[model samples]
Target: MIITHDLTKRYGRTVAVDSVELEVREGDRYGLLGPNGSGKTTLVRMLLGLVFATRGEIEVLGQPVPKRIQDVLPSIGALVEGPGAYPHLSGRVNLTLFDAAGAGGRRKDRRQRVGDALERVGLAGIDRRPVRNYSLGMRQRLGLAGALLRQPKLLILDEPTNGLDPRGIREIRDLLDELNREGTTVFLSSHLLAEIDAFCTRVGVMDRGRLVLQEDLSSLRAPTGRVTVGSPTPERVVALLDGRVEHRDGEVLTVRHDDPGALNAELVAAGVTVTAIATERRTLEQVVLDATTTSSDRVEAAG
Candidate 1:
C-alpha cells in the first residue's frame, strides 16, 4: 500500500531522511520504529505530501506522491503528529465540522460514521463534551475517530500510543488489529516496542536518518534461548562449553545458543549439577536496541 525508493529530504545541508526505502503491503500492520530525530516523522510527512522530498520517489496506494497526492490522499487517513481538534468545539462538532469542511461524507452518513468511529475508539458517550475537557488519551482517540471517518484504505499513525493508559493502549491495538484483519493497511510509528511486538507483523528500524533494518517480526524473533545455570563452581560449566559462555553473574553462568538440549546434556556430562536452569528470550526492545546501536556504530565507522 506504500512504497518508497531512496526517499530523501534535506533542509539546506541537514538531511532529514537519507535515501530511505520502505514498502508496506496491503493488510499489513507495519511498525516504523526509531528514536527521536531518527527521520521517522520526516518520512511520514513526505509520504503525506506535507513536506516535499529533495530526491527519490514515494508512492502511496499506487499513486506517486506530491504529483498525485490530492488524488491519493483522499484514500488515506493520517494523524501525523496528533489531532487538530478545536479546543472550544465539542468532540462531535469537531468531527462534524471537519466532515463538512473537507467534504468528507454526506451529512447523515457523516453523523453515523462519526458516531461509529467515536464508539470504536471508545469515545461515544463523551461526544458532546468539548475537546478541552478531554484527557490526552481522549484527544488521541478523537484524532483516530476523525481519521477513520473517511474509511480510508490506509491509515498512517505516528506515536499513536502516546499518552494512552494501558487500557486505552489495548483498546487501540485491538481496533487496529480488527482493521487490518478486515483488509485495511495500517502504518504505525511509535517508540513503544512492546505494543509493536504485540500487533505489528513486520518492523523497520531506523537510526541516523536511515532505515537500518526491516524484517518480518516472526523471523526476527526466531526462538533462541538463554540458559543461566547456578552452581558453586561456574567455571567448570563455562569450561565445559568450550569458551561459549557469555558471562558469569556471581554463581550463575549465562550461555546463549539456539540449542538448549545440547547445552543441558553438556552440563550434565561435565558433572556440574545445575541448581537453577532458567531460560531467557530476547524481547522486542532488546532486538531494537541492538539493531539501532549496531547501525549507529556502522554509521560512525563509515564517517
Candidate 2:
C-alpha cells in the first residue's frame, strides 16, 4: 500500500532521514521499529505528506504523495504522534466537528459514523464529559476512533499504544488485528519490540536516520539448527546427547538437534525427565540488535 525510494529529509546540514527504501504491501501489518531520534516520525510524516521529503519519491495507495496526496488521503486513516481534540468539547462533539471538516462521508450519516467509531474504540457509552477530563488512555482511544471514522483502506499509526495499560494495549492490538483481517493495511511505528513481534506480520528497523533492515517477521525469526531442551537433570541430558550438546545452564541445554520431537522421544525413552523441548529460533530482539547500532539518543565521550 506504500512505497518509497531513496527517500530523504534534511534540516540544513543535518539529515533526519537518510537514503531509505521502504515497502509496505496491501493487507500487511507492517511495523516500523526505531529508537528516539531515529527519524521514524519524520518518515511517517513524509508518507502522509505532512512533511515533504528533501529528495526521492513516495507513493501511497497507488498515488504519488504530496502531488496527488489529496486524492489518496481520504482513503487513509492515520494517528500520528497522538490524537488531538478541542479540550473543552465532549468526545462526541469533537468527532462531529472533525468529521464535518474532513473530506468524503455524507453529512447526514455523521452522527451514526461518530457513534460507530466511538463504539469501535471502546467509548460507546462515554459520558458527555469534556475531553480535558479524559485520561491519557481515553485520549489515545479517542484518537484511534478518529482514524476509524472514515473506515479508510489503510492505517498509518505512530506510537499508537502510548499511555495505554496492558489491557488497553491488548484491546488496541485485537482491534487492529480485526481490522487487518478485514483487509485494512496497517503501518505502525513504535519502539516496542514485543508489540511489533506480537502483532506485525512484517517489520522495518531504522537506526541513525537510515533504513537498516526490513523483512517478514516470520523469515527474520526462522529456526536455527538447534533445539533448546529443558530438563530437571541437565547432566543426564548432556551425557545422553554426548557430542551434540553445545551449552548447558542449570536445567536447560542447548543441543545441536534438528528435530525437537525426535529429541523429546529420545530423552523420554532414556528415562530423562524432559521439562521442555523446542526448536531454537532467532528472536525479533536478536535480529534487531544485530542489524542496528546503538540508540541514536546515546552519546559517548571521545575515546
Top candidate when judged by TM-score against the true structure: 2
Candidate 2 weakest lDDT stretch, 10 residues: 291-300
**Residue 145 C-alpha lDDT in model 2:** 92
Pull out the clashing pairs in model 1: none
Give the C-alpha miss distance for residue 38 in model 2, angstroms.
Answer: 0.8
Q: Which candidate is the best by lDDT?
A: 2
Tell me the tens digit of each residue's lDDT in model 2 across 75-172: 99999989989999999999999899983399999999999898988987773889999999899999999999879899999999999999999999
In model 1, state the lDDT of residue 295. 36
lDDT at residue 85 of model 1 (Cα atoms) = 83
- Please, what are the lDDT tens digits per residue for candidate 1 over residues 1-303? 999999999999998899998999988889999887888999999999999999999999899998999898767878878888899999999988888877376766887887888899999998999899999889999989888887888999999877899999999999998888887899999877888899999999888789988988877875656676788888788777887778898888788766667777778887888777766666788788887853322444454
Q: Give the Cα-based TM-score of candidate 2 against the true structure.
A: 0.95
Candidate 1: regions farther than 4 A off: 223-244, 248-253, 265-282, 293-303
Segments in model 2 whose C-alpha atoms lie over 4 Å from true places: none
